[model samples]
Structures are given as structure tokens and as C-alpha cells.
Target: MEEFSPRILPLLWRRSVPARRAVGRPPRLSVDIVVTTAIRLADTEGLEAASMARVAAELSVATMSLYTYVPSRPELVDLMVDEVLWARGLTSDGTFRERVLLYAERTFAMYRAHPWLAEVPRARPPVGPGMLAEQEYVLAAVATLGLPVRELNRAAAGITTWVTSAARHEAESALLRRTTGLSSDEWWQQRGELWENWFDVGSHPTMTMIWNAGAFDRGADQQAQDAYEYGLGLLLAGIERSVEGDDRVP
Candidate 1:
């Protein structure tokens, strides 16, 4: 398994100037526009490319105009995240494993929809109604696992962390392919040229086997949900196996 990225809690901050609400004035704007504009910026230019100025430029509004709709970039991010995460969800009307798998698939779908989401830190928990609903639904799905709250929390965190780590890998790999002008499969086909001379026969048999099978075959599927589900099953299976001898899971 690949290692997890250092727990990066990228700071989300509010815009410095607060919206000035004049006495006896109605609300200046709706939250929907602010949320949608922020999401569009992220989807198009990437998360780091999104800022108040960029969002305003996208919306064709003055930068100060957004303050009335959102307090700050962090608040806008919170809202944008909530909007996308709930676009689809899982149900609890199935076996625990089935339900968890469905949830895992749904989680990956959102990340695939907006790749930047996988990079957002969960420093401050999502508090929007949609995000709360997603959390509640996931919690309910794992209820049958019979693990303590902390253990269940850890399991959920592990699954999500794994998803993001994998997504980051695929995203970076895609960028490298574009930059170096070589598909992963092409890179793998020629990788031996770089190290075939140094590879020892006995110690590198495993690598040789993968190379023979085209180890660089990144799935050509538009969505990587199946890959995510496959990994989720292995993780859940390992946990189940570990708990079998213990009296923890009934």
C-alpha cells in the first residue's frame, strides 16, 4: 500500500474585510451564486487557483460584492464542498459491507467530479446541512459493524484518507503524463531501459512479473470507482478477519 500524505490541514481563512450590513438594509445577495461561482473556479483552475479575486472575475462582479454573500474564502470553500459532496449518497438498507462499499463509491464519485476536493483538509469538520447529512448517513451504514465509536471513526477516516491518497496519485500521474508526453503504459513499456542493467534476477522477480503484465496499465475508465471499491473491500475484509478471533464484533 502507498503511504498517506502528511495530514495537511491547509488553512482556510475568511476574507479580511467583513461585509458591511447597512442599517435597515435587506440582504445584498443570495448564497447560491457565491457557492456556484466558487465551485466553478475550483473545477476549472484547481483549488490553489481559486481565490476571492478569481471567483469575482468568474462571476463578473466586484470582489467586494461577494462579501455580502460569503464571509470569506474559507466560508465559500465550506459551502462549495457541501454542495458537491451531497450530489450523490449511499443508503443504509443493505448489509454493512454493502452499505459501506456503496458509501465508498459515492465518496470517490464526488472526488472524481471535483478533483480538488480530495485535497481539502478536514481541519474544520463540514457543518453545512448537506455535509451533515452525508456524515450521518455514513455513520449509520457502519453502525452494524459493532465497533466502538472511536474505532468506527478511525475506520471511516482510514477509508477516506486512502481514497484521497489514491486520487492524488492518479492526478499527479496524469499531470506527469501530459508534461513528459508519455502515457503511463508507454512509460512502463520503456522503464526497463532505465534500470534493466541494474535489476538483479532473484530480488526483482516480483517487479519483473508486474512489468511482464504491463504494471503501468492505469485503468482507462472515465471513473475509478471500481478501483476504489476493490480497495475498500480488501480493507474491510482485513478488519473483519482481525476481529473474528476477538469478542469485539458480534
Candidate 2:
């Protein structure tokens, strides 16, 4: 089998053509099966657990044979990420703000369900159909507003970025609690006692006041969600103001 290149990765993902196979014999594996198995491993364990060997083992195939469908573990992971994102439907009907918020909420839910996605390094944009579909969805929502091309791209990116950050926060916190066997409240309770003993509350009157106001009593999950919704509202409001101020926008 030939090595996969960045130029050809999109072709492979879009299924521009079926993968090369034997003439007289039916293939025993497929790219979808390989990616699905890898995703299962990652979802059940962690990203590191979805090694080529483990994925092949789970599929009951020779490790090298697995390469016939997926060129490398990185390629397989890329495919898995796209597959997960593709499964999520991102569409809604409402005002522009409402549509954007609905999409943000769905993206948040997806990341929470697949926390391993937070570990993936997206240094470059993904070109997979799934990712592009998501991009198209956002652009379609904002297209009627008549924003410039630059602002349109920025608006789409802003909403997704906000959701990704919020989702990562919640997912990381949950993972930490699972690893340490301590709930957020329990961990903070212990820290609270230590602060009472050695910390100088007088040094930070503003924080001290907020802390005393029962703000911390709200669970971390609730606080994270509240902050995300509040911030999203502010973000949408700013965008609306920009649209209204710029006569160029429709």
C-alpha cells in the first residue's frame, strides 16, 4: 500500500473513491470499521489507548493488515475525529442569535460526550467533510446577515471556540475528579480550611466578599454552565450591535 499524504487525506475521507482492494477477493476490513473501533477505544479509555495495535486487536486483525485501510495511527485518529463530528447534526430555525446559540449548545454537548476530543491538537484546520459540513452549517446561518467574508469567518469561529473552551473546562474537571476520587466540593472544602488557617483574607477584600456571598456554594458544573451561557449572551449581543452599527451589514 502507498503512504497517505496530506494532499490525499481529504480524498480518502470523502470517499472520493473506494480504497484499493483485491480483484477476486472481498476485503476483510474497512476504513469506517477501523475508525469506529479506534473511537470506541478512545471513548472507553483515553486517546493514548487507541494505539494501532489495540485497535487492530479489538478488530481481531493483524496489526499490519490494519494499515491497508488506515495509513497510520494519526490518520486513523483524524478519521475518528471527523466521524464523531459528522454524526452530530447542527441545524436550527430561529433568529440569528438563537441559531448560533443552538449550534453552540450542540457542539458543547458533543465535546462533553467525547472528552478525548479535548486532547487532540488542532494546530491546523481539519479538511474532513465532517468538519467542513460543520463550518458550512455556521456560515449558512450567518450568510443572510450580509457580513463581510472576514467577519463571517470570524463569527463562525468565535462561537465554536467559545463552546470548545467551555466544554473542555467541564470535561477536564470531571476527569480530574474521577482520577482523584474527590468531588469539586470536597477538594475545595479541604482548601478552604487551609486558607482559613494561613491565608490573609484582608489582602483581597473583593474576592473575600464574593467568597462569603455563597458564590462558591454553587457547584462547579453549574458555575461553568452559567458562565458559558452568560458569556455566550454577551458575545451574541456584541455581534448584534456590530451588525446594527455597520450599515454595510444586512
Q: Tens-digit lDDT track for model 2 on 9-69?
A: 7533657665576798787777778888888888878888899999999989899998887
Please identify model 2 stretches exceeding 4 Å from their true place: 1-4, 7-12, 16-22, 246-250
Cα lDDT of model 1 by residue, 148-236, tens digit: 67667666666656655666556555555645888666666676665657777678888778767875355443325456657877877
Which pairs of residues have clashing backbones in candidate 1? none
Each prediction's whole-model lDDT (CA): 0.64, 0.77
**Which has the greatest lDDT?**
2
Worst 10 residues of 2 by lDDT: 3-12
Top candidate, metric TM-score:
2
* Residue pair clashes in candidate 2: none
Would you give me the overall lDDT of model 2? 0.77
How good is model 1 by TM-score? 0.68
